[model samples]
Target: MIGTALRGIFTLPDLRKRVLITFALLAVSRIGFWITVPGVNYDVIEEIAGRQAGTWIDFIGIVTGGRLTNASIFSLGVMPYISASIIFTMLVKLVPSLERLQKEGPQGYRKIQQYERYATVLICIIQSSFIVAWMTSVTAGNERLVPNATFSFRLMAIVSMTAGTVFLMWLGEQITEFGIGNGISLLIMNGIVARMPGKFSMFISNIARAVRQGVNPAKEVTELAIFVLLFVGIVAFVVLITQGQRRIPVQQQKQTRGRRVYGGMRYYLPLRVNQGGVMPIIFAQAILMLPIAIISSIPGLQSIRFWFNYGTFWYIFAYVLLILFFEYFWTALVFNPIEMANQLQEHGNFIPGIRPGRRTAEMLEYILNRVALAGGTFVAFIAIVPQIVSSLMGYDIFLATILGGTGILIVVGVALEFVQRVEAQLLAREYEGFMRKPMRGR
Candidate 1:
């Protein structure tokens, strides 16, 4: 495998250079993740973060690849930028002017990206203000998160965070231009992967402690092993599903003019089973986290805290429902069967046995809906199973998270995308792609 990968990499000079550039950029980004923003006490932030485990803070930190917990300048990570992009995406779909811009091809898309950049800065300012305010309020028996919450401090925090987000966004764009997979996704995945070594160490430590105390650690070790096995299994399953597609056969009609036949051929349009990818889960998590975050932030809601705590039945129930809802919603936003059908019809292509227009659209929609149902169910299951396991096994939610679900999904998805890009490069250079059969020498 290593030989094949090396052969593939060396086959294309441009691809190899791009991959190297991506890693270099990623290393710089990771370094930025450790550089704390000015005016914040790192020790206090770390203590607060440790205390606030399992809350929305953990979720944010995980996404930022632990930068938020570190109170780094890049604490906000690319989330603000992502949030801005999502907002504009919705706006483009709703507002006629923006929608027209979207229809205008590459130039217009660049314009929209510029708009997103502006929006990202604005969002960073707003989010940073709230973060500073929240930190000011956090007091553990008179030890406040922000020791001296002055106007200058607030200004500094906001400016630093906004600048950090902008830099991170720029880094991501650079990675896309000069690296392998999408930069933003790679950044998030890197953060999540960074936590794995610590989790594995903890698992080993727990087994050691149990054994030293003269307790039979077999059950715990067995459970951890099973969890690991399940984690790998789910990752494999996700890769399969993420890559799975329905290949709709397309037979082109013959167009004969005088002496020559121009267009008689067959091909396929591969529609992925999970066309929406992890966007649905990301959207759902953001939406679901909102209410819990709000409720947790309000002091008056302390009486009903049990109802909103993470890993609780109510929380898991609501989380799963939101995941399902967003799966359908995102699918609707991105997948347009009618437009596809029309394009196919205009080109004189039709699925075998299916009519050219609306009927073909309906058939495609039907298949998509069925495939989406399976995919959605699997995603929801993956999202909720870790919580269930954590609760049952008496392990930390963090440990359970590392074992299966969202973190694993992001890891697998990003890795697969990276591999696919590499394979494409290799194939373009007339080298065998990763999964192709090796040629035998005569």
Candidate 2:
């Protein structure tokens, strides 16, 4: 099936073009990941990163694909843009004016996008400033990451990082316009996947070291096998949840027009179980990082740090609560039961055993809440898998992240999205799709 899909993809001129464009743009972005901001020493930053494993520094590296580790021009990556989008998305719901603007159709959407761009720039400036100051302050045995931290250097870093992010934003937009899959997501997934080879190598090297020391490498090897099995199970579980949906049967009223039946059909409205996707996890992680960072930075607050530490009981509890909260929060923001009900009513469609107005809306909200709770619980569980693996398996947090958890979830989600996109292109052109039998129609 994969081989057939590969052939089918390149067989079409337009699909081939989109595929090539996506790869080309992704290659350019990958190159930018290595281009450091001027005057920052990559070697020193890497050294500091090594010593600071399991901190927010490592988290940033994992998310941005090593760009932050080098203080690269693209260090900010697409996160600032993502952050801007998330902020504006919430605003559009909470702010009446923004909500009105959102209802104005494509023109309003474009305006909101413009505002998000402006916000992205402002966020980049604020974030980059802190990053610059932090990097210059980081010292390794009398050697600073930024040797000469001058105003000029700060200015250059700020401009360089912001420009890099803006360019990446533009590149992602282009990919959305002309390429296959979501550009920004593809970029992020690529970043995560790019680091995998090195991590797997490190895991392998650790096993070899254990064998040499006669530390009973058998246990570690057993762990590796278990890891693979767990990974496959988790992936399958993710795909199932990601694609899971509740199909609400809707009936259209039969209509008579000049002795001809104009309507009367039954179809299902598929409401996804995990409509919020990875947003909940992303939001929870961002919010969780703050308290730990703030508390750890304060003098004499070291005793309280463990309370907010990643794997601690209180920390995990709060993290799970946040995930559940944000799952409903984001779902409420994006999905409107009222709107769905209105559309169904206007079209003379009604859910079986439910009225076409407020009742339908109420039912939808009820079902959505239940579905979202399940999804939220699943995501919260996945989020803590890394912590569990790190503690129980005795693997480095970085290594554990790749083996299972948010990293694998994002990788799987994005990969599935990408393949589905390519498959869609193939199906549109009457070609067989990846991991699917040939359809009867184009």
**Which is the leading candidate under lDDT?**
2
- What range of 10 consecutive residues in model 1 has the weakest lDDT sum? 433-442
Q: lDDT tens digits, residues 1-442, model 2?
A: 8898899878888989999999999999999888888898766876876777667766765665545776889988888888899899889988999999999999999999999999999999998998898888888887889989999999999999999999999998999899988888888888888877876687577689998887978876777787778778888988888888899899999999888997789999998887777788777878888776787789998767778777889988988999999989988989999999999999899998998899999999999999899989888888888889888878677777775556677788888899899988888777788877888574
List the pairs of residues colliding in candidate 2.
none
Using TM-score as the measure, which candidate wins?
Answer: 2
Tell me how many clashing residue pairs each candidate has: 1, 0
lDDT of 1 by residue, 1-442 (tens): 5587677696578987998899898888888778876766666876776787766787776655645667778889888887888898788877999989989999899999999999898999999898878777877665666778899988998898889889989989999888999999898888788778877887688799998999999977887788788778877787888888888889999999999999879998887777666677777787766766677678887644578566777877877787777777777777788989999999988998999899999998898888778777878887877787777877788778775556777788889889889877776666766886543331
Model 1 spans > 4 angstroms off: 10-12, 64-66, 140-142, 208-223, 292-305, 438-442
| TM-score of each prediction | 0.91, 0.94
Please list the C-alpha lDDT of all candidates, in the order they appear.
Answer: 0.80, 0.85
